[model samples]
Target: MITFSKDFLWGAAASAPQTEGAALVDGKSPTVWDKWFELEPELFYEGVGPEQTSNTYYQYKEDVALMKKMALNSYRTSISWARILPDGRAVNVKAVQFYRDYFQEMKSNGIEPIINLFHFDMPWWLMEKGGWETRESIEAFAFYAQVVFEQFGDIIKKWTTFNEPLVHVECGYLGEAHYPKVVDFTRAIQVGYHTLLAHAMAVNRYKNSKYNDGEIGIILNLSPVYPKSTHVEDKKAAHITDLIYIRSFLDTVVHGYFPEELIQLFKTHQLLPKVEEEDKEIFQRNIVDFLGVNYYQPLRVQRPKKEQFPAQFPSAFASHYDWPNKKINPYRGWEIYPEGIYDLGMRLKNEYKNISWYVSENGMGVSEEERFLDESGVVQDSYRIDFLKEHLIMLQKAISEGSNCFGYHMWTFVDCWSWLNAYKNRYGFYRIDLENQFKRSEKASSLWLKQVIVENGFPMTDERKG
Candidate 1:
């Protein structure tokens, strides 16, 4: 019997390049995703690239119709930096018109758009100039942010400065998942710092814009860390990992400063990113209006006997392990921990000032979801429906205790291209039928969610069968 606020946002999210696949059409240039698939075709799942996607670029009208059918009141989508500025500085007039029309269409359908400025699809041209790691790129992003505010600030009431900046730094600099695959955490630190500075600048710009009442914030993937065991060593490991992974971004965005211990750890390794004195004050001045939290899985860490790689990344002092005998999502290979959602809510209530927040991206990604399709054109994705129910119940509990959350947007509106896994795991309320002209079909979860929105809660347990 979980209920939500009356104004709770019921919707889904998708990014520009992932869904809108007009790769190089009508003055649109390639993004890093396009160039990556070009350089490393084998890296993508089934050799699929960014160019072949859900074709929302042309099919936006039809898609908005589907959103209305699902009774969605909100939809989050990113404006493709590449589409907006093919060459990264000059605005493309045609793309501008396209977005204006698309957004207006959604509004006409009674769907409010939660627009994000950047969503990992960095313009390939921008990446060439040292993307986010250089001060020049930071300034470039701030300028682009200003342009977005000036152009769409009136039509779009809700805006996100950047979506998951940490993922960009981790994948691009520390991990090998993204383009320009490198493993230098020193460089990762620099990218992370510059991104925060960029976000602060954007927040400041938004406050000063003509549409000052419009909401602008940044989205973060805040997966909490847990100790593998009660041992002191394991607890220490979890704390260190939390400081690096979660607090490094959260503290700065909320409190306007990095975790002091994290900075000291970096200093011990002589790996701190170059910081300017004025930049510190900038963050202190412009904290976010709201927080967009994307939680998928929590990390469990165990203390290592010694430094695993002192010569490698700056914070490689701990080891991460899986929760013992944890229930797992067989499709995406992530642990199923619904309680983590509740824990996150309580953390915000107790510690993070209970600032307004939303479950911006929390959905299961499954493989070969089309197998469950019936003759009537519905994919019987009962697994996804159950997954949402479990998480939403926790969210309901959080709300009952006052977490200041107002929305819950599933990861995507339609199945779109993932970074490295491409189309391997499908996470959409609607199915993407590749063989039948990129068709979009309804899934069981969409119908179930529609009812949840209609009721503003999961039906009582006895009525669930109804």
Candidate 2:
């Protein structure tokens, strides 16, 4: 009974640094990821670096053919900032050709290409100049965005300015999980603000450019926060967590302002990031045309049992956020909460005026997938199929209730490299055997997705039972 619109886009997402091999070829400068892998190989899971990923840079045509076979009408991929602009300021003509050709190929095949301007791949040169923390780097980012808009805007109409800006703030700036690791909350706040500024600047530039059909927006990973209990303190903690994590960026991009709680928290801690008087106008003037929500899981918050740790937690830590007691799926540590999707849809619809949105990234990551393969070489990844089905059902309900959600693009097209996890957690429909020059093997979930796309709804029991 669950049916999507006939125009609903079904596809997979990938990033250049994650799937593209030949990291150093064709005049491409080293990115922060390249420098990180070179300096700290041990930081990655099992010591597997970004040197050899899914090899999609060389095999994009082959991969695109595979996507067509999977019945995809749209595809999402990021253009490496370092690839196009070697130092983040100057354009590389040869590198420009590569992406132009890539886009042309997708268009030729009747596939709509959604291009992301930046996807956590910071140029090493920019990092040396203070990266996103410095205003200079923000200007360089805007310039780079303008270059991409001018060059590829003819073919690529849908553009995402940044991917999961919160992840970059939490993981790279605050948590020490990604490159240029710095665990200062104040710096994290500044970085988060500057990223928004960069996005807004990019939006301004894209709107003023020659492209008539182009649209610019930012992609945020919106994880809905829940209260562990109905207690007043628990509810308050959940509210704070949501403001700090989700609304911090959502409000700025959608409503053209920062969350009031975030401002107060920074003011109380005396850790407010410096902002110019003119910056507020820039943010207000450059609201997004759409939003891309990447939903993985929801968080459960409750009152903290002890004092805050010696390490400075950004905001009030009177409470803690923890996952609710539920059956955990072993593939990925995230809890399965299908209703979170519906909740997020309703929240966006009510708070943000239901701006056009799409599920950018949603999937389960498995530790070891090769063991689940059947005799015919198809991996029986029923868990992934179930995960997608449950989420899609919620999405259908939300859409039917007037959410204005456009489409759904899964986490990835194939098993690609995750930042610190590297290849440890595989999250792809097409399994890539890294041992054999990255051989591609379609999993059972791929077949399931193909039928879902073709039928525009959940497949019958007989279709999925076999």
Candidate 3:
């Protein structure tokens, strides 16, 4: 009974660094990820770095043809800042041509391109200059954004400013899992504020440009926070977690302000982010045109009973995150709550006036790809199909209840490199044989997705089983 509109965009998402090879070719400088791999390859899972991934950079024309076979009407890919601008200061002409050709090919193949400006791949030069912590890097990011808008604006209309800013803040700044390895909360907050400011500045710049029909927005990994227990302390902890994790960026981007709870929390902990009065007006004046919600999992939180961490713990949001023992997906080490998508959709509807939105990224990652394959190279990924079905059912329910979700684009198009996990956790509908020259084979989920897209709804048991 669940039916999507015929015009609903159905495609996959990817980033340049993950899908594109030729990392240093055509005047491209090294990104932080490349530098991180060079510094310590041991940090990544299975010792896989971002050298040559799915090789989409060279094979994009063939890849677009494959997308046509898959019946995708839209596709999402990021432009590498370092690829376009070797040092994040000057645009590389050859790199620009590569992207222009790539976008034009996608369009010629009847695919709408959703281009994101930044996606976790910071230029190494910028990282050396303090990355997001320094204002200079923020300015450089705005410049990069403006250059991309001016150059590719004619071909790409759907633009995402930044991909998963919270992940950038949490993983890089707080968790020490990503690059720059800062565990201090004060720096993390500052980085978050600067990222938001940069996004706003880029939005304003794009809005005033000649591409009047082009839309610019920010992509947030909005995981709804849930308390493990019904206790009042647990509830309060959940609220604070949501405030710091979700509302911190949501309030700034959607509502044009920071959450008062977050401000008070930072004040209480003596770890407030450095913000200027003038920057506040910049954010307030330039709200995004749309919101891209990347839902993967919900966060489980509980009250912290132990003493707070020392003030010098090198993360931005110090003494805040507390997690109680909860059920987790053993495959990916992430919580697997499906209802979180519904809760997030409702929250966005009630709080943000039902703004135009889309499920930008959502998928499950599996460590072992061989388990799903048969002798014929066919992968019966019923588990992945079930995962998508469950989440989409919840999404369909939300839509029926009046949530203004425009479309859904999964986390990836094909199995590509994850930042830290590298090639360990495969999350692609089309499997790429890494041992070979990255030959791709369509998995069972790819066909399932095609049917879903073509039919514009969930297939019945008889139709799906076939």
Candidate 4:
């Protein structure tokens, strides 16, 4: 049988832009996502943008009620930078009131509010001023973090500096998925560097204020890197890939320095970001109190059989291969390897000295899920239940083996808009009926999860086979 600790946290996470639809209303300015969708509507599926999201701003009460039904004791939500700091500098009073009310409601429902400061929603105004590329903009972010901590200090305690820093830097700078899609590795390195500094500054402020006995940390999406073959070159490729993608941010805020080989690789290619002497001290002083890990899938890499095309980033230097005949999420095109979570957990325990951590984001995203709706208007998403069950079992195995993990938050609470992908992939426990004024219906997985949370865990025979 699989069981979790009585203190284990069971929750779901959602970001503001993906859930809150009042994008420009109530004194809220534009986030980078808001502006990006305006400029490149074609980039998003079905031309849907942040403004037409799950309308969480207005529907949060109903959502929280549903969360209570699911027995979610801890819920993670990001505070939009644009909503709080409309112009990137001046404070937005109305936005502050909204968040205060939001936090109050969550507390009223007995749900722990785990607030994240940034979740890729950089204000459009700041992006115009070079965004994370400049230290001045980094200071702007730090000030914004101070504003949030000061305002909601009494209600919220678990504060995350940023959600998925690598995703922000990689997708927005090197890849074409996110806003300001500049294909420059040098710029990516710069953004990545400043993001770590911003996190450090925020952590410093969080500790200095000591608000509500708060614990501050950053959420990172980590995946174990694997070599496709037993060849030496392939193993080397995987090692380098892991350093660039995982350790670049992990080692910096955790250890106050970049991985030697990662920095050397950047220096070898002259891709180092401009850094000031004061950054060293800042990085050293503001280590995280805990870690929030968002693990979805692992990366399998191989050495290039032929000379790869000239690339500007380390990720592009290596070729990737899917596991031979492995199970996969057919809808989202991602390989399903539940044991990878165990691998990541062990790595943190061994290498990171067993820092306290939690599974912040882990769930399956399925497209066109409406087809699974039964005649009774409920989605029999038993598949989603299986996905969660398999993953949770692995998480339990790690915890029993001495990993300092205490929480498990699925990817989302309700069906919310995803970036670039928009509403194509549904990861919510409650299926949002777009045709019926966004009416929420609980899928089978939600009911199962509610029971799992209620019982702290479920027996091994509980998961029904498809």
Superior candidate under lDDT, 2 versus 3: 2
Q: How well is each residue in 119-229 modelled by candidate 3, as lDDT tens digits?
A: 999999888889999888767888888899889899999999999998888889887888888787789888988899899988888888877587888899998877767
Per-prediction TM-score, please?
0.97, 0.96, 0.95, 0.97
Ranking the candidates on lDDT from highest down gives 4, 1, 2, 3
Give the Å error, residue 297, model 4. Answer: 0.5
Error of 3 at 263 (Å): 1.3
Give a tens-digit lDDT track for model 1, residues 4-45: 878889899888878888889999888888898888898888
Clash number for candidate 3: 9
lDDT (tens digit, per residue) of candidate 2 on 272-306: 88899999999999999999889888877786665
Q: Please report how far candidate 2 places residue 82 from its true position, in Å.
A: 0.5
* Stretches of model 2 off by over 4 angstroms after superposition: 307-311, 318-324, 459-466
Winner by lDDT: 4
- Give RMSD (Å) of candidate 4 vs. truth: 1.6
What is the C-alpha RMSD, rounded to one decimal, of candidate 1? Answer: 1.6
TM-score of 3: 0.95
User: Which pairs clash (backbone N, Cα, C closer than 3 Å) in model 3?
Assistant: 183-314, 183-315, 184-314, 184-315, 184-316, 185-315, 185-316, 185-317, 186-316
- Return the clash pairs for model 2, or none: 300-322, 304-319
Candidate 4, poorest ten consecutive residues by summed lDDT: 308-317
- What TM-score does model 4 achieve against the real structure? 0.97
Is 2 or 4 the stronger prediction by lDDT?
A: 4
Write down the lDDT that model 2 would get: 0.85
Q: Candidate order by TM-score, highest to lowest?
A: 4, 1, 2, 3
- Error at 366, model 2, angstroms: 0.6
